[model samples]
Target: MAKHHYKVGQTVSGITKGYTSEGLGILYTEDNSRFFVKGLIDGEEAEAKITYVGQRSSYAKLTKLITKSDKRIQPKCPVSTACGGCQFQHIAYDEQLKIKRGIVENAFRTIAKSDHPVDECVASPMPYYYRNKMQIPLGLDKKGNIISGFYRARTHIIIPTPECVIENERSNGIIATIRALMKSMRIPPYDEDKRSGVIRHILIRTSYYTPGLMVVLITNADNFYSRNNFVKALTKAHPEITTVVQNVNKRKTSVILGKRFRTLYGPGFIEDDILGIRFKISPQSFFQINPLQTENLYKIAIEKAEINNSHTVLDAYCGIGTISLIAARHAKKVIGVEINSRAIRDARSNANRNNIDNVEFYTADASDFMENEAKLGSKYDVVIMDPPRKGSDEKFLNAVLTLEPKKVVYVSCNPGTLARDITLLNKKYEIKSITPVDMFSQTYHVETVVLIERK
Candidate 1:
């Protein structure tokens, strides 16, 4: 409909930033064009090759590095740009924090129409190797050899990342062991084009403070060659593996896990200890990827809720009751609800495992739970909701308003959706404070915690 500033396959040199008072061009091209830049940073006079141009966004790759920014450093991950998992690995860590804060501030400024004073991003204790979980796709590389790594940006091509610094250190070794075993055993990697092969993906979850680790091998079929011996060899190599499960996904879909699962080794799940509460996480359970930041996040949430001995709390979308059990320690009672029955079962088990009698859980949608509670004239002094990236819907927020909780603490993973949700909640609540946490260190994504008061 209109003339575009850049073109695909065109090599542009040192495109200047569309300047703003907040100086928000550290990683993007201009204020108007939503640009996804790789191997390129602002303030560097380098030439980048425009790869893909879309209606609302564009992508560019640095063809040649004429000059480097002052904040750019040698990325720790060997497959930094190839993997596309962490875009900010090259930028200095301190600069990354500032960029994340600015992102949240910008979302609030443009979407929420609120000049909220966002706090400095809370830094992760371990900037590198902080992720407690890793999911790697299994496929044959160009040489027709079995390999496991992350997919390339926007493509299904696999980039071998043996030394990815963001993932847990032990993950690489386990992947290598599996690869070697597959090679020796003549098991082929999954071929997407042919829709043949056995292994599809490998998902690993490691406990932050405990000696529990689980490995899940996603396959296209239930049975494989020498399954018993394979499990034996895998366990012998990595004694830290507490459990191993096999998930079967036969459909030709992009989704990783299927409906059926069979335990090939010890238990079907693993447990992690955080904030003095033990959480049982199954393969499908929605747990935080960064355990170190998750501890800090839960602490910040509980503290911001300002729960007293006399207060009652509601935890919506509570997976495994991480926040509910933590809040139960400070409040008189806590109630948690989720749509996934499996997560509710784990939450109840977690509560009983920790002897937390004050917290209760239900297998129901959060919005429905809130609406029913409002209709029943039940009240909660504080409500803590950790919604998905899309954030909570308006019906849930409206129900929350009817409940009139004195304070609401929202833990958001996506800033854009957080701002949109806040605008809806503004009809009944006023923002008090906002804080960003560096849950994902090397990536552009951020986790934010906001506290609101009923008007």
Candidate 2:
């Protein structure tokens, strides 16, 4: 091992060379040592204090600004710098789009080893107040005051962010109401250290195309105290609140949601419309956070798929059958598969609610289902896979290859994993086109959709 040139807490000045995919600015000094920083832009000169140094790189906290990039702007939210929910809130929106495109291009070039021409990122219409859902943690301050906010960047410590610029305005009111109820009702917040208290977290979901709100109270116990009065008061405070569900999380882990659930009022779910199709959203189901951009993202994805009346589309990870129902209108038949039975239940109800019979949904592991489809000699003309942040596995990719769909439409959130999976699928499929959509505004995360065809 060798001694490093800089020590922790020592401030060093450097010009930013570029940005990492996680929206951290890469700075280089005269010694060629690299440091990753946040809230700094390209060609910006700044002095940053070293926080942690590793073998090849280090992370720093911005201390002083020497030269500011024109791309920088005044952040809308006061706690934007501390909240882990958003990055790039301090940068210009146009420049943020450029950086996201660069991120997608860099991932494909460096990881996939392809010089594919990446398209410009599709900007969201409402960059601010675009988020339809918010999951905030609850705790008590030192004075035993109820606090509701998000976690600090890379840490579990909550930072009070009541007026998040990206979330719906009603979310703030809902949170404020809950906090008041916690204080008045004498409900103590869950203490992670001592594993005591009651309310753990709260998830509020709002819809744009529809008129409904869903409030999911994540609790530390199954039996809520004064359950009827609590529900009545909450709904009365916010008349828009259509459904309220309780999820008990007694586990000693960091994960927020638990397996047990019980609906206290209403249908326990809310319906949102996308692309002329209605979807029933559950408490824990996976759905796009931004409604307007989700519409654009799905439109771009479907346009790239280019399905016809003769085509059969297979939607993997088809939560609530959003894409499946939309594609069913254009394709002859669409089959959706997902592992979450609850999401499958909502997906089926959505299909029936819309009276669309051309689509069928199955609750099964995508990899296992596709592999068994291979064994059964079932075929599909087009396969649309919208996997999680980890992307698809080799087993799923191999199964996709075995199925030999004429076209593969991959929708991904992580560029690195998307590029890696595309590299493997490239052996059997040729990349047709790639498009990036700004699903998450003021964040480093970008949603990319790739269209591939059999070589």
Candidate 3:
């Protein structure tokens, strides 16, 4: 990192760009070469400071937007840009969908064009308050006061938020209660720089199946407070909270979950119902943030899978068996593979609760499972994958190709990685159609469903 030379009020010309990870950063110039910014968008002139000067590209921070984009809107949340939870809150909701659509199309044209051209991007029906889970980080200000909020983008520094627009009113109320508790207890907030703290983060999950909420406290010290007092306070304050647990995370890392967790109150899990399917989700389980949009996404994925009584489907990265249970109704057998044993257990429990006997879940890496299954001469008619934002690995893509499934319904959050994998699979599959679903409203992130048929 070099001394930021680009001062405020300095006008610099740059191009607007859209990348997979780094949101719309500005493409500036220095020494007659191009330098890109990380926290900027297109068509906006900003008084920015060059944070880093690298061999290829430089990073800059926006100080002032001299000329803003027409799509820019008054961010609903007070801590919009600072909060890492969302990326496109400053842009208009309608424009956010449009930009996400462009992101999906660009990925197809650039990475998966050899297969078949993408037709249109599907826009999400609802944009706000779609999130079902929210993790709030606990931090301290300069005065050593507790500040429970979200981290700033690309930084561990906590941006204290009075209210979050993405979270539900119930979830937000939990946040408020936690804040009040911290103030009442007068506990020292976590200090990232000094590495001395108590509470690190708070995890909350809610569903319609349960009357109470699930609360997990992540902390370093073991003797922070009496477990009885903590649980008693929480139970009295919020009786709807049927579950509460304390997660011990001593390591100085950014990840939420740690190695050990202890139940402080009620059961160790919460139940979430989806399309008549019931699932048990723990603190570590991976579920979709937006439940309503997820219904739409799953509907599209199941439809594309083309389930029948005779068909066998494979659901890869099937967290809590959300798709497996749904597909089980139509398919003779649905096999779901996941890396997390916790999620696998949840999926199995979900299947049993839903009375879907046709689905089987395994706690193994999907790519490895598929490879071994292929060697054993097993095959599936339809394969559905919902990978992380980085997309599927090369090995997974190759396994799917080798198996030669009749159809593949690929759901992706990151368009670039999805495009790259789709390009590899294009050798044996024809790109049938692409639909972009706007799950996170007021955010640049888009969920895309790509339908591919055997060539």
Steric collisions counted per model: 0, 0, 4
Q: Which stretches of candidate 2 lie over 4 Å from their true place?
A: 1-3
Ranking by lDDT: 2, 1, 3
Residue lDDT tens for model 3, 1-455: 22255443344555454534435654545433344554455666555655556654565666666677787777788888778888787777666666777777776777666435554455555566667678888876778667777878778778988888888657777777776777777665567678886777888887755564789888887758555665687679887888988898888787787889898888888887777777788888888877777788888888877789999999999988998888888999999999988889888888887778888899998889888887877889999999888788888888888889899999988888888888888789887888888777766677888899999
What lDDT score belongs to each candidate, Candidate 1 first? Answer: 0.85, 0.91, 0.77
lDDT of 2 by residue, 359-395 (tens): 9999999999999998898999999999999998988
What candidate 1 gets wrong by more than 4 Å, as runs, is: 1-6, 15-36, 52-58
Q: Write the per-residue lDDT of candidate 1 for residues 323-371, one digit (tens) a residue.
A: 9999999999999999999899999999889999998999998998898
What is the alpha-carbon lDDT of model 2 when measured against the actual structure? 0.91
Taking all chains together, the TM-score of candidate 3 against the true structure is 0.90
RMSD of 1: 2.7
Highest TM-score against the true fold, candidate: 2
